[model samples]
Target: MTNLGTSLWLQPPRNSPIWQQLATTIQGLKPIFSDSENFEPHITLTSNISVNTQGQVDFVLDRAVAAAKCVPQGFQIHLSSVKYGSRFFKKVYLQVEPTPELLSLARICREDFVYMPEAMSQARNYQAMSAEERQKIDTQVGQRAAEWTRNEYDPHVSLVYSDLYPVEDADRRTIETRLEDTFGSGYDESGLGWKNGRFALVRCEGPVDEWEVLGVRDF
Candidate 1:
């Protein structure tokens, strides 16, 4: 990775059979956001935890793996349903049925988030991130610590542009219509039961769109 900063993600196996099904839907919904398909698909462990070295990332991942306490290499996850509805931030999802391994991964990430605030201060532009924004970030991180640590962890991979606006607009409806035409409504759980195998560390590149691979841990 070129730049050093916060944020680490869990990139799923590159050549997995599951990506074929999920990619099609994710690609089809790309008009909603430019960054949706700009980077390889992934599920985040910690959105932001400051660090500046590949060694630190690998160390944290190793601990996270150990904290997992001998879970299976591939976790059996079931996609509950696809929904396109009233939520502003979310437009669609391949809702995950959180298995033990999945929950453990999330829990460990929270318990031992490798965030050195002093290190983060060096990386982050405090000027750009206003006091209010910093507070919000702090509050959100605190919330995730509790939320993902407990059973309240609602793990779901987004299928569309999560930040897209116009929730009730005609354009959104058109997208929704297309979604219905292609994937159908919330009631269908046709595609489920995938074994999520392997994990990679991704450095936050630019924004939420571009991500650079730091390391991989195959278990």
Candidate 2:
């Protein structure tokens, strides 16, 4: 890795048989957002913050791995029915049921890698949340998240770009229904792989060198 300010993350490994199957299924679906063929499923841990040097990245990674090691291994999470976000409806998703461990891990990462105040200020909906509010939501689902869990964790990685707009309510519902009919009942539940956990810190543009390997971890 060449960049010092590379962001690190704990994500699912790529190249697993389960991921391959899921990707194939996603590619087969009519557009939901983007084909899963382009990527594998993974939960993002740390992001936005970056390591400035290769050595620094390595150190941070080692720390992250150690932090993750403290977490129990081989916990099973169920994949529930597929659901569509009415608000973010164009994108189809599989919601993950919140687990104590999952919530803890997410909280740890949030404390360490929260988006900077100025960074989020650019977004209209990105309001500055107090530490307390952040903590509360870290483990608890709000109204939208609660509704998502009604069936199970409908953890679908996006399948099309339908979330785009002006498709009438009926069309949106039709799209949502079609997605469930296509892959609603089934979900890929293979254990996460750590290899896909690897990512690079790159200049948001330019050459491949802009991409530098960072820390790797699994959800």
- Candidate with maximal TM-score: 1
Candidate number of the best lDDT? 1
Off by over 4 Å in 2: 1-10, 30-37, 73-77, 86-90, 115-156, 159-163, 166-219
Q: Across residues 61-154, which tens digit of lDDT does each residue of candidate 2 receive?
A: 6655555566656443434444555443225555554565555544554444443332344444434777675555544433323333333232
TM-score of each: 0.64, 0.51
Question: Candidate 1 regions off by >4 Å?
Answer: 1-5, 32-37, 67-69, 72-74, 84-89, 114-148, 167-191
C-alpha lDDT values of all predictions: 0.59, 0.43
Clashing pairs in 1: none
TM-score of candidate 1 relative to the true fold:
0.64
